[model samples]
Target chain A: MLPFARVTVIGLGLIGSSILRATRSAMPTVRLTGYDVDPEVRGIADRIGLADDIADSAGAAVIDADLVILCVPVGAMGAVAAALADDLPADAIVSDVGGSKESVIAALRSALPEATIVPGHPVAGTEFSGPEAGFATLFRGRWCILTPDDATPEAATVRVRDFWEKLGANVETMTARHHDLVLAVTSHVPHLIAYSIVGTASDLEDVTQSEVIKYSAGGFRDFTRIAASDPTMWRDVFLNNREAVLEILQRLTEDVTMLQRAIRWGDGDALLDLFTRTRAIRRSIVEQGQDDAAPDFGRAHE
Target chain B: MLPFARVTVIGLGLIGSSILRATRSAMPTVRLTGYDVDPEVRGIADRIGLADDIADSAGAAVIDADLVILCVPVGAMGAVAAALADDLPADAIVSDVGGSKESVIAALRSALPEATIVPGHPVAGTEFSGPEAGFATLFRGRWCILTPDDATPEAATVRVRDFWEKLGANVETMTARHHDLVLAVTSHVPHLIAYSIVGTASDLEDVTQSEVIKYSAGGFRDFTRIAASDPTMWRDVFLNNREAVLEILQRLTEDVTMLQRAIRWGDGDALLDLFTRTRAIRRSIVEQGQDDAAPDFGRAHE
Candidate 1:
């Protein structure tokens, strides 16, 4: 149904390895190859049979592959692209799984001069990373956002869309800038807010600090999960997607300040109104199935 | 190990019913009586045998209660206290399970002029509500802050402390004002922020809104659970504990704003530093066994 006969996924981190596993399972006839700059990750993938074969280098992995996916951190896209630029098959479709699209496109395009690159982001992930953290169902019911700048060909874009669609992702296209902006509001800013709040609580004196942890199930524990995401990858995300995250953060800050004043001034109406208004949004999310009616956390046993 | 002959629990909500269930199992010899304004809640408690006996009215329940715990919302504390005020035995010690201690203390003090009143708060709960939402283990290994103002006699305070200790809650004491302020920072502000963000995400246009829910696992869903809390109860919390909530909320807003600016300016160092600093708090929480180290969420089957 699709043109990709030999697909090579580089960087067997959560996203890369997941794509490799899913593609392998769904497109059984197509040959799948994998590579990770980290030898240990490649070894693990080989041992688990996540790929048909594991390659030693990026160039070797993509040499004859018809589809090449850059699944490494957003910051590493450029170097990986450059390393494989010379050996990629002429019509190979190059795509990625980066959170921030603008920087990813800029970096990858500069290195791979002739590939049919369809810049995309699967708005799906877990807090865990590396090959073992991935499973085939990771992409089920998630969104795969395609950011096809002017350089991407229509045919290649369609093919990329089809690939993700078959993978069970609801695919949509938007400009790179808008993707970053919306995500800044929906994901990045929220994450930064979580990190900041957790940091603030951590700064409390030792005795109070221990109590905060002891009673975290009250609310603070939720923030800690987001704050505990892979530090290096998150650090790179903030660095690359700074502008959009900052903009949303600014608006959130102002809103929070207004709330702070209301609390300080003992304004019950303001507090109740906001709390009530926010509860409605949660109801909407539940109606949409984004959240389970059961407890939203501690799903490890599943 | 505790001295109470009969313990009456008023308003069998999540916390109240939990206290009764825990007490029933811990002090099998002590008579546990329960009363709730909600007929269904009372029915559930009766069916579950959470108490030795059930009463239709607060006064009827408190008549012989050596220990009476008012577990209604902070706003309703006054009315509940007043209703049972004249009936409380002279030697009866009254307490409460309100999130905001100051308001609960002020209400009960004015109502029961002849009874010994000592205010307390158990800093633990689940997102679920009603009698069905409680368990004996809810208070196990949790902290219970006992705010016995200067008027409470040492002997009375010690008895109250012993009761909580026997129920498996680690007990500590703080002034009513201090307890309210500390909880406002560690719990209330975080909840408000979660609700606000979830609300904002809900307000997004239809297309973007669907994506918000679909990809909610990124970070937004955590806020949804916190926001999904009992609306009326939360509304009361913000209303009754307005002062301290507002104060801590003010500090949080400032912190969120600073982070926003860092993102806007593409300040990687700022983002990285904040992210790294926040990781320590999570580590502390994990070390304290307040949270788990696994992918703390997404384990739906459990």
Candidate 2:
């Protein structure tokens, strides 16, 4: 069954356009309206026929939307939500695709006090950004986490869950705070570390940039893939999820320090134990169908 | 012309068996001898025709070989080299595929003072190990670094270079010390950080194991691929290249600390600048043909 007859997507970038494409493929009968703060993106969305109606403004997009999804950066969620406040239907259920949930939920509640708000984060994306970078299958078999609090209506939560499920995601629910913490560990900290390592490699005096790029396939290339993600989005994620990200970063730094000491002292046993233990987790991820079991992450060698 | 008429590989793991397969494909006339410490590996090598002959022992494998390549973990290089010392031909050119070149070169030189030693590391491998995990094209378009000192013969170094080139690798030469430092930055430290992060994620009490596995596609899955590399090999790499790895690790830790402070202080501009700068390096890597430019590292999503 269709979750909503009229759906509006604000910020028609990767996540927003992806939702439009997936909805078009999955629920062809539902009416779709889309808008982006950038006129260039709006023109591209129109050229691509991304929605049934490409609205001129956020307020125009959500005029009678039964469901309104904000797909802007976490830091921009509040401003974007406020843009549509006066025009949103009283019965509209608002949600967002932000990496951090707590800040987004608070900002959205502040902007649309009388409307139902349920923040969501789909645990799927490529390193690419913008409307053209998205595809329909990006969220297939991936998890979409819904951070809905007790104040949220049960029917609204169920509708959101049903919507994500219809789009080929396995939906799970948790508190906004818990969602922030889990994503901080699983996503934010890893990206921060990847960015740091790539920056370090580029700044090395002895190792030329060309040399680093040449021999990157050795191991550094994997980090570069994650580091190549959208900068503005990541900056907002770290800023909005500061406390949780910092806490996890602290734990990661301590773990790295322990390994550093082991290498300095030639503690082979400690190194081997940790290395062996980590391998099991990779196996579990593959077994759960969360990752490809093929060697080298299923990369084709030529 | 083929580098050598008779070539012996003293270990039948991923690197060793790849050499055997690549040699077979590139130089069909070359007589290949293979041996492994594990009887099961030798049996598998024989069953799979990994070499012209699967020798019963390392000593027997190099008895008449003109070129002998030791493909073993960095920690086992010394013992493996010593095992074939007495039986090695007087004019044999000795080389090894150890990640840490300095120690492997020193160990090979000490174990066979009269023989020519040109230690090399083919900067190519999958996370998988064992004879069954090898392919002829594993080294295709990858860098193969040879660390040959002034005391080493130029002819021997050229011969090793030619062998790798024939196997579809781009070969380069440098000092053993410089090779260790460069690889520590490019490969060793990356692996250590990857292992540490995976370990950290698994040990977190607030996030359950199932949660980590389910949501790993966010960013953690990239680290898991590198962490899933052979434990014994990585353990040996860290121990053998202690000085270089430690130096690089220190730099990485400092970089991480800087980012950590940015996150803690909500310095979104600082975070955005670093993230933006890192994306250029990824672009350079892809432009150099060192990595795929496809979205999500060319991961197949079904």
lDDT for each residue of candidate 2 in B46-98, tens digit (9 for 90 to 100): 99999999999899999999999999999898899889999998899999999
TM-score of each: 0.90, 0.99
Fnat per model, in the order given? 0.56, 0.83
TM-score, cand. 2: 0.99
DockQ for each numbered candidate: 0.49, 0.86
Candidate maximizing lDDT: 2
Please report, in order, the local distance difference test score of every candidate based on alpha carbons. 0.79, 0.91
List clashing residue pairs in candidate 1.
A246-B264, A263-B246, A264-B246, A299-B299, A300-B299
Model 1, span B244-302: residue lDDT tens:
77666656666766766666676778777877777777778767656666663644411
Provide a comma-separated list of chain B TM-scores, one per candidate.
0.96, 0.99
